[model samples]
Target: MIYHGIRLKAKAGVTQEQIEETLESMRNQGRAIPAVKSFVVGRDFGGDFDCGAVFVIEDLDGYGEYLTHPAHAHTDRVGMPLVEKFDSYDITDDDDPQMGAKIADLHRRRYQSDPELAALVSKQP
Candidate 1:
């Protein structure tokens, strides 16, 4: 299993509704890709990014398929331009129950701890 995690910031002036819609689109896009075990997207509030998504796939082959998926490109086309910038982290999905929690904790910690990076992703100036 593999974990593909992501965070996104809406372009300055993009509406909140638009951001949420884009996230949902991405979740749907992830679902359409072959071998995607589970996928989700959501808005992160009072935090670094405006939105985020996560995808779990079987392996590198599946991950590759997801990357080339038309739905992914289409969602990217719709969502990317609407965001100032974004960040991502990928890790080998560990079978240990604690590993997933650890990875998720690290993701949140990075967001909560990094301001400059967040600003950069938000396209400040």
Candidate 2:
């Protein structure tokens, strides 16, 4: 499995509700794609200066499917116009063991510590 972490920041002056709605719609659209296993969208809760979303995709191939999907193209047409960036990482025991462990620990300390995210992570297969 591969985890594609995407971060998207809406244009200035855009409301959080609008961003959330657009992302929800995008996730729905993503579900129709063949390769996508699951989609999770959430707002950045770290601080006030940041207005962005995080998505955890199950597979890199699915993530590619999403990029080329018509619905995603339509997303570029509608919504607050996001500035998107992504980091792709393969889930492997041998690659950067130390760094991967640190990142996993951080994720646990941050999102997993929260009841909602903890539940979400726990539910993942």
Candidate 3:
């Protein structure tokens, strides 16, 4: 399984209501995506970030599906603007040495296909 995790810090002056809305959107994505075997979305305690989320997928194909899901895009569009800082990482049990490169390629292709999404990511501050 691949456990994809994200940590984020909200921008200064971002209201609690807005943060909740984004968190709810993330919760919805976790529930709505078929590729997500399990998920968690909550505040980050011992980290520099303010919040974090993790999604577990069975395989690389499932990870791709989770990333491309409409709900996932919705969360990004609605949540990214409120983000001050963001980081993501993946932990997988797969033994393939190329797995890391393959995952990075998935993100690269995604950004290439959707410039708007890339722009939103670039806007994070």
Candidate 4:
């Protein structure tokens, strides 16, 4: 499985309620996307970010589906503006040496296809 994760730090003055809403939105994205095998949305304890989420997908195809899902876009639209810092990474148990490059390519194509997502990410600190 591929575990795609994101870490987020809320902007200054962002209310607790808004943070909760964002967290719930992350959970909603996982729930709405069929390609997601499982997911986690929770606070970060000892890191630069305040919160984080991880979505487990079966393979690259499922990862692509998760990346482009409407619910994922909706979550980004609602959550990104409140994020002060953002970091994303992927961990996979696949043995292929090229797996990392392949995963990066998936994200590159996603950004090329969705300019709005690229723009949203560019705004992060």
What tens digits encode model 1's per-residue C-alpha lDDT throughout 1-125?
Answer: 88787788777799877877787778787768877899878876666787788898776567666665778656666776777767777778456767656555654554366554445435532
lDDT of 1 at 108: 52
TM-score of 1: 0.69
Q: Per-residue lDDT for 11-105 in model 4, tens only?
A: 99999999999999899988999999999999987888899999999999999999899898888998999998899999999999999999999
- The best candidate by TM-score is 3
lDDT of 2: 0.50
- Candidate 1 residue 116 C-alpha distance from true site, Å: 28
Query: Which residue pairs overlap in candidate 3's backbone?
Result: none
lDDT of 2 by residue, 35-92 (tens): 6565565665554323333334444345555555676555444542443332223353
Using TM-score as the yardstick, the better of models 2 and 4 is 4
lDDT of candidates 1 onward, in order: 0.70, 0.50, 0.92, 0.92
Give the lowest summed-lDDT range of ten residues in model 3. Answer: 44-53
Each candidate's TM vs. the true structure? 0.69, 0.49, 0.97, 0.95
| Full-model lDDT, candidate 1 | 0.70
lDDT of 3 by residue, 1-125 (tens): 89999998999999999989998998998899999999999999888888889999999899889888999999999989999999999999999999999999999988898899999998876
Clashes (candidate 2): 0
Candidate 4: clashing pairs of residues: none
Q: What lDDT would candidate 3 get against the real structure?
A: 0.92
